[model samples]
Target: MSQIKGSSADQPTNAPLGALHDIRVLDLTQALAGPFCTSLLGDQGAQIIKVEPARGDMIRYAGPFAKDAKTHDFGNVFQNANRNKRSLVLDLKSAEGQEVLLRLVAQADVLVENFSSGVMERLGLDYERLSAINPKLVYTSIRGFGDKVGGESPYGHWPAFDIVAQAMGGLMSITGKNENSNVRVGSGVGDTVPGLYAAFGTMAALLEAKSSGRGQYVDVAMVDAVLAVSEVVVNTYDATGVSPQPMGNELRGFAPFNTVAVKDGEVALGAPHNPQWSKLCTIMGREELITDPRFDSDLKRWNNKTEVYEIVEAWTSQYTRAELTEILGGKVPLGPVLNAEAIFADPHFAARQMLCEVENPRTGRPARITGPAVKLGRTPASIRHRAPLLGEHSREVLLEAGLSDAEINRLVEVGATTINEEQVLIKESAVR
Candidate 1:
């Protein structure tokens, strides 16, 4: 067997004093939400075993494949969400595979799955059964709608892509130019936010388990999570008895917090607070507007937002982003509407260590990827490894699970397990 070269055990350890370092996560998720949650855990130094189906996670094939790549590139999207974890492939439908999974569960601290509500129960790996093996395991389930609460709805069993959740959760209603033209946000916030909440819930449960000596189930619905983020829309309807319409590049309640044209490109400014508004006037060389009744108070300015924006834009359009940034540097919240290439070249991103480069052993090239969003000073998150090739650590992971070499080989022969070189090569060759 060819050794996998960059196991976490062999990496230079800056073991983050992260809160979840002691936790172990068994990730049986694919695509966006569930993997994103586990990625957060992995970033915080938790050990994550990403268990993929026999054919592998679908995201591996969802591309923008790498430049001139032959196979599914594991695209930037997958790489971004799946770093700092190990991969283990197993056929969950096989009896032997189920046995191996149960063995892994015996030692796991958490099990995260985003399959439809009852799938885990059908596979005999549901929270009730797994908790029997390890009573302290935190079992987290991410679904379109939670089984315990909303599973009987007609949409519950229907597969929900990100857009479906966005539309149903009120995000689409408030997203675009107007009421008739509801648009989805560019990113997968519907999936991503629920995953984030699920991760938070998992950690909270883990902390509780420490004292109670028992684990609990965490159920996060994508629609519920999206609704949580749509508080503004819900609150507006409740308070005014009016459904809010989409106002592109404009905030529903705030004035001068929207996009304004600069000399070259556009910048977004949020001088919502009184002091920030005053400071923004000073930055725009229009200090007199601070006392002008039409633009003085937040309420008055909100009523006349179009005129207020016109005044602000008249001043902003004359200056470059640098000039605007220098004027509003610490006075008001401001940022340029940067594109992808511009963001990659931006200094603030580099200074904050928001971007990092990891060497891809297969490509023998450095792959630049985004680092974890939150920065913890004491136990700062660090990238330990590039995203794994399919089944990259299968043998080593099963070995750690106490499986012998012959057992691993038997499973491999029976189409119950796979390794990186075999599976990824077929994928890579097909694309090439």
Candidate 2:
């Protein structure tokens, strides 16, 4: 309902681009999941006003900051998750801070938070109150378990992290070397996947709000997101009335649908179809196995997959990862398991623009980060700048929001903002 007024940033080169460039979001999130959600939106060119506490986000101080960074706030974890966002540090526990947040909410198209259940209500900034100010605001929440506004699961009060999501969401049960051992996913997919869902859900709600002239709550639960990704496990259990256990790296019904050993490392290869299987057999110089009774059909080969893997590995084991790639890269579904160093070195990543470079704002040192995954030919998503320092854009953001210099100064004096007179003057041009 409010007009977009200011978008000038400290660095003129880092102009926002993409379809969502005109949209504004108030990011009241911290740590991984919530920040990840907003970061995705920011990557697509949303103006993300990241509202942090006076002390700043937990991640800002919880570093391993960038090498020789003037500010300890430039934590690599924070940098990786918070690119393209502008920071505003405010004391939201105070009345003045609440008033400021409400003002921003009135102008923002969306507001996202990931605090546990009842935290918003306790802070007196719940959706019911904020929506009354801006009926078109798309308020979204990311939580471990959903709240009353959603399905009202009894476990809403439970403290959860990535491990809880993996365990409770059935991911761990179906992911290990054996039935007796369950392993959490290697990364924080539990947080990231749910955050991704939240970002999508927010987009859906925003699209609907455009036509309906009203917004609704987008509730995304981490556990639910994990379960959604483990679709195969659910489908198998539902279809056969049998729970699938961790069957190692092999696919239960598909022969040669797993990684095989190479001389230096492992490469995942799949040849579960007849044509591909025949090609693989020929390549291995074991042409007779293609029509042998035990390995005649894909299903028969699956029934004897232990032998299938042995035969495949026997051929693969002699070659290094690079050698196997040269021999079998195009013939079958193949992926070489890569480490960080390999990813950085791989030409494929560079060609695809998957590895992006940006400068650390405090240090002016160039750093590489993963780039925006969604490629748009017309209006591409750009990494305009690195993540902000704590309260880096507070004065500029408020000025852009139409607050006068005097009013901003008063708030700073009242301890509601972490801005000084010098900081207030530093980015005044950002509003111009």
Estimate the TM-score of every prediction: 0.92, 0.92
In model 2, which regions exceed 4 Å deviation? 1-16, 67-71, 420-432
Error of 1 at 80 (Å): 1.6
Model 1 ranges off by over 4 Å = 1-10, 14-17, 149-154, 421-432
lDDT of 2 by residue, 317-403 (tens): 999988888988888778898889989888888877787666565555566777888878877777777777678788988898789
Backbone clashes (count) for model 1:
2
CA RMSD of all predictions: 4.2, 4.5
Candidate 2, residue 42: CA error in Å? 0.9
In order of listing, the candidates' clash counts read 2, 0
